[model samples]
Target: MSRKKTTRHKAIIDQLSVNPSMRVSELSDALGVTTETIRRDLEELAAQQLINRTYGGALLRQPAEPVLSERHKANVEERAMIGKAAAPLLKGARILMMGSGATTVQVAKRIAFEMNNITVVTHSFGVATALSLNPTIEVVLAPGVYHAGEGAVHGAQTLRFLSDYSVDWAILGASGISPAGPTDALMDAAEVYACMLRQSSRHMIVADHSKFDRMATARFSQWQDIDVLVTDIAPQGPLGQALASGGVDIQLAG
Candidate 1:
């Protein structure tokens, strides 16, 4: 297929995935293509078993599982900056709750050395293990079904355990973000993060700048849900304005 045809097909797939039953005219308007062209792309996607043809447009097929580890390595510096920005918030925290992510792991290391009287609650093996030997800090692991690839505990048991106590602060990471909200690449992770958010008083999101423009499979929280957004650089333009308007505090790390 030609480049134009491929682009049209991808657009149709994205739209159908988001809105399973769109009219051809709606798809055309959204993609800036003629209705006939939308129909052609729908037919092509249906032929590839990518979608199910409806009366007008198409229904989305199930998407493939995303590779989480490869994505973690994509922006190392930004994550480090986010870690540095988030560290200061942990200074006075007595009970800290952290979620699983490379950035959160960095934050864990930063707090391990400086913070005392700290009781760390986490679903991440990385965080738990990192602070395991810190005599000044106490580490509490939330028990649940562990996924090796993600190296985090998740499921009903974890959520149940987390609900039993509230924390002073919760630090989290997102797979992506836009003006609407922050999202996760995995549904299971999103569920666990939601539980963490509810069990903490101060909700802090530690996401790198790259997460700002992307989209993901499962949305966990809106920008408003976050009390503070600790990122490497300040987000500019409409996204930044939207976050600010939503009362999300922003912090930039060098």
Candidate 2:
């Protein structure tokens, strides 16, 4: 796919993720493209199984979220910046339970490269492997049914395994962060992440600004439970108001 097509495809998926379903004309107007162009884009995205083509629009694929690997490729710079900004929050944290997501993987990589002598409790294969580069940091992989697409396991067994230990922090990434708070497209993550928040003393959510004002299939956290939010750009509009009202410390990565 061309770079333009890739960017547009990401936008389509992002839009569908926030709205659940979007009409062709709506997307065309929003994206500043012709209706026919929007139709063509929807058809291509559907063929890749990234979205479900409707009669005149599209819907987010049901049950599961988009492929993790594909997602990590979308907001590369933003994820990296958010990851860097979140690393310091882990400075005094001895043990942290982290969820599996694209941005969380970036956070793990940053932590491995910058921090040490810490223990990371997680079900994400990517997080564990990223932490392996720093021998001083212990990597504890939670046991569960493995998923090839996510390269992680955030399911019933993973939740059970993590419930046994109380950690210094629960650091996670979200599919969407709206006025209501953090949400996830994957049910496995939606449930397991809430458990993580309960099992830890502090909670931090890492997401790019693209997720601002977006809502997803399931909510993983309440506004009162969140300690901090790290993102590339400062959230504005209703998202900004909500974060402020919730007393969440917003950190912008430069």
Candidate 3:
């Protein structure tokens, strides 16, 4: 496709994400394109099963599973900053429960290199192995159904296993964060994180600024459930204001 067509395709997808359904005339006006051009884009997207074709434009398709490796590559510096800031909070904690994600992986790296004499209970195979590199930290693996792509485990077994232990803190990562609270793309993973939140004394969410104001398919916990939020930047706009008043303390890593 041409550069213009590629850009138009992305714009169409973005608009459809927010509105779900749109008309060709509306899309053309918004994108500053001719109606025929809009129609061609819609047709192409529909052919790819990225959208459901309607009379005029199209309806949004369900979002695909976000790849873990791709997520790990995105916002690298921001996640590292957030990780460094959050790792220090573990200084006095004896036991911790952590969820799996790129940000959390950064936290694990910090813990492995800096923190010591802490016990980590996690469903992430990668996290457990990472923490195990530090002889001072005791790593406990939660057994459950494995999600190979995510390098984590989630299901009834994981929840039941976590119930056997109480932790000083729960460090979680999210796909999206808003006034409504933290959300994840995967349902089973969300369930495991929800269990961790309930089983810990304090819940701290670690996410980058990009996650703010976004909505994910599955909401795992409410804003009130969060004790602290560690991120790369201070949130701005209405979502930021709402989060500030929503009771969770926000900490900027930058």
User: Top TM-score: which candidate number?
Assistant: 3
Candidate 3, residue 180: how far the Cα is off, in Å: 0.8
lDDT tens digits, residues 156-204, model 1?
A: 9998999998998988888765565777777888898888899899899
lDDT tens digits by residue: candidate 2, 88-123: 878888898888888999999999999878889998
Error of 2 at 44 (Å): 27
Candidate 2 segments exceeding 4 Å error: 1-64
Q: Per-residue CA lDDT of candidate 3, range 1-254, in tens?
A: 89988998999999977766567888999999899988888989988878756566665654554677788889999989998998887779999999999889888988899898889999987788778889999999989898988999999989999998889999999987655678888899899999999899999999997776655667899887788899988877545655767788888897
Q: Over all chains combined, what TM-score does candidate 2 have? A: 0.75
Estimated TM-score for each candidate: 0.76, 0.75, 0.76
Candidate 1 vs candidate 3, TM-score winner: 3
Backbone clash count, each prediction separately: 0, 0, 0
Task: Give candidate 2's error at residue 129 in angstroms.
Answer: 0.7
> Candidate order by TM-score, highest to lowest?
3, 1, 2
Estimate candidate 1's alpha-carbon lDDT, on a 0 to 1 scale. Answer: 0.78
